[model samples]
Target: MQLPLIDLVVFFVYLLGIILFGVSFSFKGRTSNDFQTGGGRLPAWALGMSIFATYVSSISFLALPGNAYQSNWNVFVFGISIPIAAYMAVRYFVPLYRSLRSESAYFYLEERFGPWARTYASVCYLLTQLARMGAIMYLLALPMHALLGWDVGLIIVVTGVSVILYSMLGGIEAVVWTDAVQAVLLIAGAIACIVVIFVSMPEGPAQVFSIAMENQKFSLGSMDLDFTTSTFWMVLVYGLFINLQNFGVDQSYVQRYVSARTDAEAKKSTLLGSLLYIPVSFLFLFIGTALYSFYQANPENLPAELQLSGNADKVFPHFIASELPLGLTGLLIASVFAAGMSTVSTSINSSATLLLSDHYQRYINPQISEKQSLRFLRIASLTMGGLSVLVGLAFNGVSSALEAWWALSSIFSGGILGLFFLGLILNKTKKPNVIPAMIVGVLAIAWVSLSPVLFSEGSIFRSQLHTNMTIVVGTMTIFLLGFLFTWLVQKENGKPIKSSSD
Candidate 1:
């Protein structure tokens, strides 16, 4: 169903408000430092909200619900892993990053190993952010296409340009503040959907639960130890690794780490951001369960198109377009965009920051003026946003957005977390040892991630492990092999094995 005139007005107003909110702070990017870190004066609450919004990407808004609708709450186990990761990040990474005077997350990598180490990790981070931006943009286009009946590619291009303009003009301050607003919208919108679902139930809210229980919609997948499938344990392991990677090594996250006014503030922000996802994830997943219940009780209500497996991602959006009242529908749609915009904005800004701090200043011109650096950053943001548009268009017919994104993330992440672990926990990381380790890890990662696609069905040579294991295998291969290689080198040179403090 197309949005009514009032709903269209509401949606456009919400978009305009977000754009204006960002553009209002455009002057903050006058200097490279202001653009990158908001002069290091942002409050903890805002940063925390921004971080929270970043975590609830369009994947969470749309793809996650789709997963819950089509399957079960298996991936919800992923949220169960966040607190542990948050604690680790707050305990080690916050203080470590706050101590650094550099804006780039990979600066420590360069300090520990060399420029080569920094470049390698930076490249991995940039690639991951691009893929991240692309996926988020693609998911962002879904609701737009559903509501306006616009071509998905056209929606992507238009939405990408809007985000590029916002990120380019406003930088990190805009990102943080806009993110805080979007975070509220995300939660509000999700709660609204849950409430609507419950209110619409024929037998009441309790009926939704009874129906879900009857259907086993709330199961967290089988209690099996099989790594070949995405069982609870496998998903937990994947979540642990992926969350560790996000909190430990991701530039978009670490950039927020350094933007805080104090160590306590940063730590507080990390806890707030990470723990908040647990309940919010429950909401998104339950929306799916509730949706299933709603449909089961009134099977005639569910359209035949949404009944198809691939269209699971469109279930929540279809509900918004068809079931909700006009004004609320617009609000909910805007909320979905909030999820996408916050993430894409953060990615564009952080990617630009990396270009300036990690590459341009570090390599091309160390003595570049503040004005020149700001110009470089703006241009870089636009360029990265454009590249992501191309990739978003590439994801035209993906079966499952969340599943596809997790696989792509693991591949693009390329075991950078493992390399970071080696540098942080082990002293005197050798370039030679790390190089060989990275090569082996990348090969392992490639084999695990691609074999399923490259090989035919029932091929003996295919990877038996689930796609989520791509990060697990890649990270372990790099760290374990790098550790072994490093130890052998140090022992051969008559040196003692050292610890993190050494």
Candidate 2:
């Protein structure tokens, strides 16, 4: 593939923009708090954009559109459920968590539960983030590889280290502000790609919809309520619960709330993030369905490899590589890079915070001063960044990335959410029962998630679930079981129980 002058210009601009944003923050970082939570100085809008950008990753950029092309537009409805989850987060979770005044989300777990529970929850978060970062790297690299013949391995390393360099230097301050910029770029790039495709296609939007409807592909379900399908109900339920886990317990998001100057600001950010997702997702999926029409009209123009994949995930890059005008291709490709960089930088920095606050400062160096803690923060950043790079290298393909992420996420999320729900919504158990309940909850979810048959379409019990919803269900089941067992054991011991909210 010969490079065009316009494409090169767009690519350079994208790379330069992120590097510059990161450099700007380096000079402003003064203390560990400044590094970790922007010295708690951010306003609602900036935090909202950070939350939106952080939540929408390369996975959605590629997978959701590809899913719309392949599975139908039923998945788009998940966007509707997100705002509802966001509402709950703002109304209940963020305000309550802000009152606790902890940098690491798991630190609150320690206060309400115990050391063992905190460690368990944090480790789960750490592992899930590692897999997620790897997946993001892998997805972003795919477009570059197809369009520019860039080595995927080298691209992953360059992206990983570049993100680490800036994130380590600027911390949350850099991640949040740069993510706001990336969110705009990401949306602009997607819209640009759609506009270009529409102009090049033989028919207009009406004709495109006609083709989609002819194939019965523009929908949520095939009008079947069969348990053997990833239906709309399954997606909605899964989305609602998965989001609950995210807003309720995920440390990465919780850290953002703590970064806000006021509890009200944090809640406002949460609300804004939820409201924005609906339009953002609708646009992305609309572009995807449009791309499907373009390909149907000109199948011969697509790359040989893409046609062979029989999956539309590869189509976005294929269109960019083969059909788009020169400069626009560069812009869209840059968008892909922005997606990967924004997500990896945020995850690395957030995980570093978890390591230092939840792990090192608590267990390894209890008497450390602020200056000494800053030193450890830098060290944790380097170590976690390196580990994520290695994980990215190990990701052979996108499917592996998805599996690794889901498996790691399920491990701790169920237990953490369960423990929190116990704390916030139930008043049945003493603190002493927390560790035991968390242990059981974690193990139970891990078992269900890892079992090959659990997510299989043929499974009688598990086949009815979507991946995200299944994890949420597993998490909830553990939470309830843990609550019951804690209630029983505390009563047997004649111990006065404290509510999870206490």
Candidate 3:
């Protein structure tokens, strides 16, 4: 099913609007401060929307529906933990970052521990963002390839280049405003798909619900307490830790905090963004449930390739291409790109900010002019964007985009949150103890993340610990070990442990 002429027009027009809107902001900010933090003049509501859009990502737009379609709604438990994370961010992280008034989130680590801690965390963040950008690009291209039979590489190049151009030109203001628009488009797209599913059903939404219930597609995952399997508890715990990193420590959200007008505004933005995410996520998950019901009732309507392959990810795109009215299909497709672009643009901007603020300015050249700093920022953004495209194109043979991303995220996060916890809660943790604790934390996380592969079948160390527990375990390991080491050092030197206030 090819897109009609009208749909093509709609799709291209949406892309053009995003590009032009983003580029429009490029002219407003000539200095590094203006570009990096929007000069602290952005509105809370708009920044909130931008944060929501950035967090959702193409992975949520595409993979989340597939998650619900293929299995049960247990994964939705992840949303329940988001508010808690946001509360922590609003109460602690937001005020801390606002008070510091640093362009990079890692700057606090330097003040708390040393430059080494800041550098290590920034590197981990950069690596994770690069992988994320690639994954997003790959997910965005999937529908394009399916709809137009276009080569995946070509789609990646075209979309990636567009995002890079606008992100580099517009800086933070453009990214935030365009993200607000994209967030609306994302919600609209999901709602449109739900409506289409309901209308297409002979029995309507009631029947759709009945079928979903009958198929157990509405199950909230397994209620078992087992940690080895992806039970409800496992996912809930994982979501809590992951969301903590996202809200409390991730450069993306931290950058948004810096962009807001005040600490109160920043806190409001964090809460609003995260609170809205709960319902919006359910909307996407419901689409998957509705899709499952719609297709089961009308198996004949399922795409032939999807039917044979049984790929849940293809189901949404297949429906859009085959059944949607001309203009609507394009709108939905553009929404997918919107989801991808919001996150990718943020990653490029945030990663570039970290490179310049945490490294270049801190170490190599502290007295660089605004013009030179802005130049470096743009160059760094372009470079990271290009590398992400290559990484996105290289993704192949992944069974589930959602699972793949979670696994990758766990590996790259490397318990940096533990370092933050240590700094905030333990006064005795000095600079000397920071590096050792981080080293132990990374190794512990690596063991948890890679043990299954490294130990193989029938090995003692290859215990049945779930991947969801990796961050939690890793964080604790770092904090405890770091604390103990600091205590030992203080005691040996005949000195008392000092509190964080000291």
Candidate 4:
């Protein structure tokens, strides 16, 4: 496959560095709580960077540029919505969630709603997290498969094991610190690749910029006020809601903050992560555009097999294999690995916490001791990691990693977030309204799945709307229905409304 030798060396160095960092931290984490949540003493800065690293997974590092190569830069607007969500999380969500001093974010769902609500959210989270971890493993294996001729299964195993080892050993403290390290490596690799691409090009940055402009990749328009046919409204509303749900409502993010020593520290970490994400994400998207320019300038450089796919999603990795110098190639591979490991580790720890705190502890045995809980946490972590790898291998034909994740995310985010929001904002309910609301929401989403039948043979919206977008819209509709039903029921009862737990 002609992978670069020096690149391999540098890449291994990065991997070794990550492992060493985790190992160094492992000794300090002798207890279950210490491993899982760093004993709630994470430095705000480390926590912030960990948030970015964990959030920007292998998909963002490697898959995103590949997707951008095919779709143009319109997708970059997704970053624009991040800051707004960050503000909401730091100012509101993190503070409240941290105040609960709970190990699992799902506990808040249990506290405000009910045990049923907590169970539902935790199950949804476990499903979503497992799917995401699998996708990350599958996608991350692609470059290795294409470049080094490695078996995809072996690649997945190696990737999954590496993450589990560190996460199991070092706990949340190691995850955050290593995540910070991974975050730096991840961005460094991207910037290095971009710089190398710029250097390799004949006409340099100016020419590349000119080509991107000509291709209309820099534009984020369609402010034409049509939610059905325009990216503007979709990007604004969908992006904002998705981001809010992810950071504000989801346990993955909440786990990061909950590890912090104080609410203020958690808020700082969130705000810092949010602000840094804007520029970092922009650079990653720019790498994709730069890649498009690179391929345009030298079409023959691409492998013949890739051209048959007739898709640009294959371009980014192809460049890494054929164009990059040996040392740089290694760094790029390490960078992608770092990205994948950072995310998988976070997911493993978070999922284990959910199982332990919300499921195993709450239901299986409330009397379980901390040492036993720790043992269960490790088992849960390994179990979830294994499940994700299996699921990833099972779903092999998916086209774009980013799209698959977004599609899966849209499936549960709206309903879960809706429940959380209701618990927070709509203080009128004491009964288990969220359960019915979620049931109604899930059913409504199921009904919206039938929208394809409603469309006539000549409908243009079919071409305009992606299936993922359709799911999100359907989920949103369900959330609103749940809200409306709850409100109507509350009004009929005519009792004075109670306040939120806040």
Candidate 5:
């Protein structure tokens, strides 16, 4: 299954070029302000593309198609929820971020809810990003394993080193610019994949449609008003909540807002990133459907194991390795790498930024010099990158990258997203009111996320609600409890209610 010589060259060239290219920015990142915010000089469109690339990580690049091929378009509804989430982010979150004096995403959390809230949110962010980096690393390795027969662990280490080095050298400037370029590569590669699939079918391109229709592959899942499964409504709720967390409170995104030249540009960047993904996501899903038809008509093309439901993730990579022409195969491989690089670089840089702004600079050394800060940022990025590599190795046999990420994300995201909403909705929710609500929210999240392992599978005490509801349930639980407590305290003290959301 190893790639031919030509394909190998293309892949290696991209890897080497990106590292050298990013390292060229070492001088730019030597200073504190330049490293973190790039003087707020980047144009809107490039920032938008970087945001989109962050959204469409390699996990999405590979797993979206796999999900479509395995069943139907049920997951596509997640994309459908983006605009809704983006609207709220642009309308509310963007301006809030633009007004920040520091690039730290959790600064406002501390200002509003005290150091406890900021620390909790930052810790959750770091964990979530680590899980995210791990998933993307694993997904990036999957194809290389199928194509080059390389050990997945080796590929992850090599890839992680490359991304981490670039983040160290380039800072925010390098991440944003490379992300813009890599985003284009991913989109273009996806289109190329769909085209090849359409042309490869013996029955011609129209067969893609007929085959999709026959299997109900275009379904958005059952439209039933159910929360016990990944029904259309449930996924929309999940997507909205997750997207809100990402666009609203996530550090990676908050850094982008701080880096943008203007508030309007930042808002537009969010809109463009969200809107652009709709069609791009469609392309990936369609590629999967077309792949289903391509392989269905040529059953012998796919191995018997890959035909199993659990092996869907392998199909797309297997196809890229075995089916595409020589140069094109290299390009698509580069695309997967591009997707991974764009996201990993962004996360490593942003995570380091958070570490510096929220913890090291704030606690350990408030007066550290730019040169010292630069050194610290690089060391932090390297440490986190290594941790992520270990996490990726831990996912040695997962059936679906997307599934694993969804669960891991819920555990960390619920607290911040819920707490953020509570602060926004009930301005009177003081730091004292938050401690109990957060305690309850954490317990609720832990119960929902770990119930299957904690309780017997058939136990009625286990959470029967779909896992997609983890964020939604945790968020509402915190918000509701916090609000009730706030109101109760206000009434008991005989204080006049003067809280306003804005």
Candidate 6:
């Protein structure tokens, strides 16, 4: 079904508004520092909102509800770990970065370990963000395809181009401010869906809850301790480790931290973003349960494709297209676009920041002029955006969007969290030993992350380990082996391992 004329107007107006709003910030920053970090003058709340928006991509918008609709609330175990990760970030990581006054999050790695460590971490970050941007774009295209009957490729290209243009022209300030807007729209959109679901039901909210409970949709998670399955323990552990990566090591959040006006503001932003995520995530999950109840109560309202495919992911989008009144559909669709644009813009800007700060500036042109650097930043932003589009196109036939994204993220995180753990926990570890430690860390993570894809179903590694355990195993392996290797090197040289300062 096509959107009504009014709905089309609303959607187009929203796209136009984003472009205009982003472009307004283009002339606001003149230098590379201003472009990359917003001259370190962004407000706390705005940064917090941007951080939240950046994390809540269209994948969460679509997949979370689908996840809840199909299964229990086990996946929300991931959000439970965010607070713990955010606390650690505010207490240690934020202060460390602010004190260093570095543009790149990986700069501290170079200081504590070596240049190679910084490069490796940055490369991992680039790969992770590319995968992230691609997944989000592809997910966004699904709803658009459903709504307009347009080609998914066309949708992806149009959305990708729009985001790249805005991000490339306006820089981080534009990205951050636009994200603040997108965040509000996304939350409002989710709330709107919930309200519609309740109102549309014959017996209302209580009926929805009763039905969900009867169906066991509210179950938090499984209590099994099995490592080979997605038990509560497995997801909880995975969530903790992955959240650590998000708060401690992800360039996206780290960039937000550095963009804050002060160290205290940065910490505040982290806490605020993390706290906000829990309720918002719950809202999305609730929408899923409510959706299940809503559709069950009125099977006639469900889409034919969803009915045929039994794919829960399409249910929400189908509802928006077939059920909601005209203008409201457009608004919700705009919100979906908002969710996607906020994340992709951040990815483009931050990836470019990493390329310029970590690589180009470090190696090719340490003393490049401001004009030249700004030019390069724009070029890099556009290039990354294009590459991400290609990546999105490449991932056309995934079995499950959310699961595939999580697996890709685990692979690319590369256990850099372990490297940070080493720097923070063992102050006396020698810098020179970090190279071998990182090598071992990468190899171990690769083994765990790739075993399922590379090995047969009956292979020992594939049969024994759950995918969620990859990060936990990879992180621990890196921290322990890195520390041990440092010790061994120190013993062989007959010298005490010196502190980072030494």
What are the per-residue Cα lDDT tens digits for candidate 6 across 1-502?
7679999999899999998999888866468898889999999999999999988989889989998998889988888888889989998899988988878999988888889889988998899888888888888998889888889888889889999988999999999999999999999999999989989998877999999999999998779887778788888888888888888888889998999998899999999877899999999999999999998899888756686545888888888887787799999999999999999999999999999989999999999899999999999999999999998887778776656777788778857899888888766664746666667766777777677778987877653677778888878888888778887889898977665556
Candidate 2 regions off by >4 Å? 222-228, 397-399, 427-429, 453-469, 493-502
- TM, every model: 0.96, 0.92, 0.96, 0.91, 0.96, 0.96
Candidate 1, which ten residues in sequence have the lowest lDDT sum?
424-433
- Cand. 6 Cα-lDDT: 0.87
- Each model's C-alpha lDDT? 0.87, 0.77, 0.87, 0.77, 0.86, 0.87
In model 3, the worst 10-residue window by lDDT is 396-405
Q: Write the per-residue lDDT of candidate 3 for residues 158-246, one digit (tens) a residue.
A: 88999999889889988999999999999999999998999999887798899998889988878899888888999898889889989
In the range 1-502, model 5's lDDT, one tens digit per residue, is 7678999999899889888888888854257677788878778898899899988888888888998999999988998889888999998888887887688889888988898788889999999999999988987898878778899999999989998887887888888888888988899899889889888989899988988899989999999999989899999998899899889998888888878899989888888877898999899999888999999889999999998868887899989988898889999999998989899888898888889988999889999987898888888988898899999998878876667887788888788888888777665545437779889988898788778768998898899989878888899889888878877787888964445543
For model 1, the stretches where C-alpha displacement exceeds 4 angstroms are 397-405, 428-432
Residue 211 alpha-carbon offset, candidate 4, angstroms: 1.9
Better of 1 and 5 by lDDT: 1
Tens-digit per-residue lDDT, 202-287, candidate 2: 76657778888888767876445543356777677777877887777787788889999898899888877667777888877877
Task: List the pairs of residues colliding in candidate 1.
Answer: none
**C-alpha root-mean-square deviation, each candidate:** 1.7, 2.7, 1.9, 2.9, 1.7, 2.0
Candidate 6 wrongly placed segments (more than 4 Å):
308-310, 398-404, 461-463, 493-502
Residue pairs clashing in model 5 are: none
lDDT of 4 by residue, 322-422 (tens): 78776778777788788889889899889998998888889889999878987888888879988888877865776665566655655655477777777
Q: Which sections of candidate 4 miss by over 4 Å?
A: 228-230, 304-310, 397-406, 447-465, 470-479, 496-502
Clashes of each: 0, 4, 3, 4, 0, 0
